[model samples]
Target: MARIAFIMLCHKDAPGVIAQARRLTASGDFVSIHFDGNSDPADFAEIWSALSDNPSVTFANRRYRCGWGEWSLVAATLEAVRAAVAAFPNASHFYMLSGDCLPVKTAEYAHDFLDSNDCDYIEHNDFFASDWIKTGLKEERLIYRYWFNERTQPKLYYASLAIQQKLMLTREVPSDLQVMIGSQWWCLRRQTIEKVLAFCDSRRDVMRFFATTWIPDETFFQTIVPHVVPRNELRNRTLTYLIFTDYGMPVTFYNDQYDLLLRQDYIFARKISAEALELRERLGALWADEGSIFRPRTRGRGFSAS
Candidate 1:
């Protein structure tokens, strides 16, 4: 069986995070958690107390005050990955997840699925090649520097963005590197993660440029992995299921969606609330019977690029 390391980025909802962690715990699978520095540690006291005795669980020592659209999120994730790698040397695959994320399948099913495939499961798309211009803020995100907090200084943010656009001070990504954007969640092989970390260490210029870019977490891994791994080695699909609202925020799952969620092939689902008692109970019951739901399914050796 393949040993898996789950790197979870959590901000709030202690009970929910603990429940998700418990569901994913197995003999050979390790969980590495990074709680946002901005969140009060008191909120997570129960979680730490519960998992402190579990040898399989490890917490990131270098935590970050992560902000939306900031590089801090990516930094925290890297810290979790580093801590996990150090703690679980035998881990074959590393999965990035959020506190709200819950396993839709059993731990045994997840291990078997990963063990059966060699390709990295990640979702990505070429930003310039796609109709990203339709999103309106694509140029602003790619060209101008958004170092300041948009929420605190909305006028200054827009003024700076406008000046950069009017002055045509648009910056180009490194000529050799292709810009890839995607969902933040992914599962990568141990070798792939090591290669990506090495690339980051050697390429300080690329890292510095992306530091001021909007939502760097969504692009950092997506951009670096393609350069390190061959196209045939990538699955180009995230195994987690998320429903987006018109405003682009992920919709929280409820008890009513239990049957619908179970019908999907995704191994996990996200953005569930800790207080959702009915949904939590239903999901718990489903997890107990996932062995029957996820019977061994055969496939070809490699994955095709999307």
Candidate 2:
């Protein structure tokens, strides 16, 4: 039996998150969630109460006011992964997910895939060489410090960038470390995670450097993962099928896209709309059905996402 531990970084949609947790637990997988400290207290309570009875579910003790493009997102993820590690040491893999993500494939299918691969499934591309980044600072994201949240404090964020550019104040990524960037969602093997966490404990300075780097959540793990795992053992791909618009926003899956979502080959699809109740309900039914494994009707087709 291949047991998986899901480390979810969630900020909103209590009911939707609860449903996701329940579905994973029902499939005999463990879930560790880090509810954002800035989220509604009532929503967190509701999620906790609903899944309290399940022994497979756990919540991270450390919470942060997670913000997009801030270090807090990485901090929350670290807490969630730590909680999952402490609770389920024997789990074969630790999968990182978001509250808005939904499983597009059956649990059994994913388990079998992981069991056979015996390697990490994380999207990692050379930061300076990759053209995947659509907008914002590229190599400069690592070279400068970002003290303000880009989304919430736009004026301050841009002002800080301008000051740094004017003053030519910059930092360097450690020569030994190869900077990599990719989608935050990943499914990593247990041993890979153990090595990565051990590295973090030993290299406090590296963590400190990334603390002010723009969107550390995307680069922190991506850079460290390669250092721990060999290139041959890494699959530079994400299991979650997520598409971003030209403006760098995820395309939300709606309730009416039932057939489209069902045909997806990936294990999960992200940024599902909160209003997509019908889609969630239908997917819930599929997850609960244990008679047969769900297969994609379409082949050689996948969503165009980085």
User: What is the model-wide C-alpha lDDT for candidate 2?
Assistant: 0.86
- Clashing residue pairs for model 2: none
- In candidate 2, what are the lDDT values of residues 142-237, reduced to their tens digit? 888999987899999999999999999998898799999888999998999999999989999998899999988888999999998999999998
Error of 2 at 299 (Å): 8.8
User: How close is every model to the real structure, measured as TM-score?
Assistant: 0.90, 0.94
**Pick by lDDT: which candidate is best?**
2
RMSD of every candidate to native, in Å, equals 4.7, 2.3
- Weakest 10 consecutive residues, lDDT, candidate 1? 297-306
lDDT of candidate 1 over 1-306, digit per residue (tens): 888899999998887777767766744578999988888888668789988688888989888988888888889999999999888888899999998777677676777788888989887788778652335577467777887667667797788888887998888787888888888899999999999989989999898888888888878898899989998999877888776654565678776877666666677788666777788777765654644665324221122232
Candidate 2 lDDT for residue 294: 62
Report the lDDT of model 1 for residue 231.
89
